[model samples]
Target: MSAMKEYALGVCYAHPKEMYDLYDLLCGWEIAERAVEMEIVERFGGDTYPSKDMFEIMQGIADILENIPDEEALVMLKMVSLITDKPDLMEEELSFWRGRCAA
Candidate 1:
């Protein structure tokens, strides 16, 4: 999942002191696959999926996260987990929380 960061929302926030950075919710984590579905519909013209396709799905989720609000980041994260085929990313998101607590 290391390549996950390539399209991560964290890349948009380079300042260490910015209060609204979404890294706490996105670091080493992946978004819900449903979010990808919604995104694909917006990106493309339809919602029907082929038998098996993940490329467009991932790109769509990344793009949706790019425009979401921080207050809603957590909810979005949870939604992504519930709707996707992937495991829940709560642990990874909380890892950031734990690091912040220690810092």
Candidate 2:
């Protein structure tokens, strides 16, 4: 399974009855993921972006819309869109991913 899927499964398992909490956890994960992506970009000093992954994640969240509800998914989608739209953020994430790939 993908890292995101694994994380989601873990969240579901950990909070089976707390759907709202699961949503919160997913949002938190996205925030942290974006932050790391930004830091990575600054660290690598690269101009390349990782928009594909951002979009993939956005789609993933969208896929969960039925389970999460439109309102909640919209909020998550907005966050994902904000991150994807920012070039600086994309660079940061790519820089980080590049480093990880190199390592």
Candidate 3:
């Protein structure tokens, strides 16, 4: 979680001064991930990945979280907890992924 700034969207603007550096920081973050995705296509992207795999699932949800306009993705996350009937564990898992997604 500490290296969240390294990812394209894994950051929270909880302070005022952060806004001043947002543009550059965000661009750098996105570029860094893009580079990795380019070099590690088998692991990071493409259609070969199975939907049931955790990495692929999380990546898909992360993409949804990153692209959507609002907190709408939270609803889908909530549905995951309902389907699993594990709200408590899902709560913590959601926090970690949200920290990872930072959406």
Candidate 4:
């Protein structure tokens, strides 16, 4: 299974524990869910610049997605869009992810 899927399904921590959680989960500073962090960026407006924390999450997301195969990442984004109320946000993120896809 892909790292993202494994993380999503609680199958395992595919990356280093620090990669999964920048702080609190490690440094006991701020523990935030990846999904919630994604929504934070969306709530702040996709076009607007991200705040520091949001940017951190965005970077983290990029690192996470990097571990996934391009096709799998696209499909995963599509699947997530179907179940999310914020399908548009997912689509927008998917577009961004597609651009960043390594292959």
Candidate 5:
């Protein structure tokens, strides 16, 4: 499946509150996918599938979450948690990204 569709599914699965609006989810997905593509290109010299650098991928995700509002950040945390299969890390990841924004 496409990255955007995979991201949307993860977000919907981990949604913390009320259902996310379709438009907002789609917009966020586009933003996230773009970030992923950029990171992939930067790290691998090509925008290829199955990124090899976990650190860069996480950095890309953190960057995306930091730019958006807190509410949207929660949704993104959920998506990241789902993708990473580490729900326990959500708050810590959020805090890390928030700290990066502060720095």
Candidate 6:
């Protein structure tokens, strides 16, 4: 089963406030993700930026994403989808970085 679905089922009996806490955490991550995107675009927009530095930045972001538990990551992605009003943004952008780090 999907981690998110699993999480939902597992937490079915938890306090309502726990869900709110998860929402708050995901919101913080969404803001951090946007900040990272903006920083990358502003600081590394052109050929003038060194590839090595760009790789380091990407890796750092990827590491942050990777450190989250898989279930929490799935939950965060779902929350981001709901919050952004652009459903594919996090999956596309963050997944690309995550893939890069994996490679």
Highest TM-score model number? 4
lDDT tens digits, residue span 1-103, model 4: 9886665534222222322332212122132333434633444435445568756655664555566655444444334434344444544544543443322
Error of 3 at 56 (Å): 2.0
Candidate 6, residues 6-40: lDDT per residue as tens digits? Answer: 77545422322333333333333434444344334
How high is the CA lDDT of each candidate model? 0.42, 0.42, 0.34, 0.42, 0.43, 0.42
lDDT, candidate 3, 19-71, per-residue tens: 22221222223232332232234333465343334454345445434553333
Root mean square deviation (Cα) for candidate 4: 12.4
| Candidate 1 residue 100 C-alpha distance from true site, Å | 6.5
| TM-scores, each model vs. reference | 0.27, 0.27, 0.25, 0.31, 0.27, 0.26
* Residue 80 accuracy (lDDT) in model 1: 38
3 versus 5: better lDDT goes to: 5
Write candidate 2's Cα lDDT for 1-103 as tens digits.
9886575445433323333322332343444355334423433355534466554543444344446544343343333334554556645644543454344
Return the top candidate by lDDT. 5
Candidate 4, superposed: residue stretches over 4 Å from native? 1-48, 81-103
Pairs in steric clash, model 5: none
Q: What lDDT tens digits, residue by residue, belong to model 1 across residues 19-63? A: 122333333434335544554454445654433334444553455
Candidate 5's C-alpha runs over 4 A off are 1-52, 83-103
How many pairs in model 2 have backbone atoms within 3 A of each other, for residues 3 or more apart or on separate chains, i.e. clashes?
3
lDDT of 4 at 30: 34
Compute the lDDT for candidate 1: 0.42
> Which digits, one per residue and each the tens of the lDDT, describe model 5 over residues 1-103?
9987686656544433322222122232324444434543544466444444544444645454454555455544445434233323434544544444344
Task: Give the worst 10-residue stretch by lDDT in candidate 3.
Answer: 15-24
Candidate 4 global TM-score: 0.31
Clashing pairs in 1: 32-80
